[model samples]
Target: MGVFLAIPVSTESFGQKSFTIDFEEGNSFTVDFETSFSEGGECCGPYTIVERFNIDNYSYELIEPSFLPIFSTVYISNPD
Candidate 1:
């Protein structure tokens, strides 16, 4: 018979904003992931803004559970 080990992996996103990872077994480590956001102008112009970030992975057991909000807003002047 062969022995097999099952590693538990869990993922959860707080408020649909950020992702949280939990590793049941193995050495503790962190990983960085890429995220992007886009904003549209509300004025008469088609102005937009884009932003990107490399967010680092965080352990759930190390910190308190909280919600992280990720959003972008664009403001433009209306010229008539």
Candidate 2:
């Protein structure tokens, strides 16, 4: 299943970013990117940064969890 999530981020200062997540019942997963880092990984800091999707909003159409190539903590961002 696929859905859209609206996460608002305010990156005005250190530790100032804040956002909310909503998902459908029984179809959401929560993944903490802070704990699952690979050794010598080139990625660091806010692995889940919020990127604006549309000019009027910052939403993302999440692909179904099973279809993903990698595994991570993902939460349902919408209602079922």
Candidate 3:
């Protein structure tokens, strides 16, 4: 004999930004972010400032698997 189970899943949104990332079981990846903004008076000149950063060699280890998996440890290298 076989048995079956049913579960309900729901998601809610409230005008917010969300992000999702996926990685292999035992792999590493790098991520970079760059942003710029300007500050000055509207009538005058607007000075612009830019900044950039990077995340290097990031990896996650899965310890257990369930509704949400637990990570054994998360590894992140130096940033530049």
Candidate 4:
């Protein structure tokens, strides 16, 4: 439905890592380690569409990272 990613790092490993998510529907955005997804993974949806629209493609530049996801935790944490 959407996309989310988090990279855990210690102060020692912290650096200026970056990434970009390009949507087929368009609102492409870039994120970095300092700003991280602490901003957001903007979702493009009508949600009740006849079918579905999703992340077109994504790429990231990490300096030895951890994990990723198909929707942010905020989407999970706030069900309203």
Candidate 5:
């Protein structure tokens, strides 16, 4: 069985934003987020773990924004 987690992001900083989902199990995912001008453009992701693994408490930060996944096939398009 896989575990799912919810990761929250602050959309107030940017009108339309996305986030890279990382796991301690050597896996990762990405989700594209959008919102109307009235809605404020905030989004959250429901992350799931495919394989069972003991994930220790970890921390992460959003270093930069890119159209590519850095080193992966995951791509998100943000249309303002």
Candidate 6:
């Protein structure tokens, strides 16, 4: 299953980026994900991507626990 999230845009900071999502029910919160690049083993590809939410301490308060995988801790391997 694919999860569709609605967020307008992101604001850049010194070492991080954050974006706010306003719900139709008049509830909204900001979600943040910090990106970094590093080398990894070939078995896991050449790099890794880890996605973390709630950097603003709001995502966990608004989103359900089970539906946070896509926005939470994720590992990615890309060969380009």
Which lDDT values do the candidates have, in the order given? 0.28, 0.30, 0.35, 0.36, 0.36, 0.42
Give the per-residue lDDT digits (tens) of candidate 4, residues 14-50: 3354556555655565544331232224674221111
Could you give candidate 3's per-residue lDDT for residues 1-80 as a string of tens digits? 32222222222211222223344555444433333334457785543232333345555443432221122344654343
Segments in model 3 whose C-alpha atoms lie over 4 Å from true places: 1-21, 30-34, 39-50, 58-80
Where does the lowest 10-residue lDDT sum fall in candidate 1? Answer: 59-68
Q: Which ten residues in a row have the lowest lDDT in candidate 4?
A: 45-54
Arranged by TM-score with the best first, the candidates are 6, 5, 4, 2, 3, 1
Q: Please give the lDDT score at residue 9 for candidate 5.
A: 45
Per-residue lDDT of candidate 6, residues 1-80 (tens digit)? 33466543222222354777565666555566554444556775433233444544232433333221233422222223
Number of colliding residue pairs in each model: 0, 18, 0, 0, 0, 0
What TM-score does candidate 5 reach? 0.33
Please list all clashing residue pairs in model 6, or write none if there are none: none
- Runs of candidate 4 with Cα error greater than 4 angstroms are 4-14, 34-80
In the order shown, what is each candidate's alpha-carbon RMSD?
19.5, 11.6, 17.6, 17.3, 15.6, 12.0
Clashing pairs in 5: none
TM-score of 1: 0.20
Local accuracy of candidate 2 as per-residue lDDT tens digits, 25-68? 43333322111222233564333332222111233333433211
Per-residue CA lDDT of model 1 for 8-78, tens digit only, reads: 22233111123333445542333222323233347633322212223343222212112113232212223
The TM-scores of all predictions, comma-separated, are: 0.20, 0.24, 0.22, 0.28, 0.33, 0.43
Q: Residue by residue across 44-73, what tens digits does model 5's lDDT show? A: 342221111112233223222332112223
Candidate closest to the true structure, highest TM-score: 6
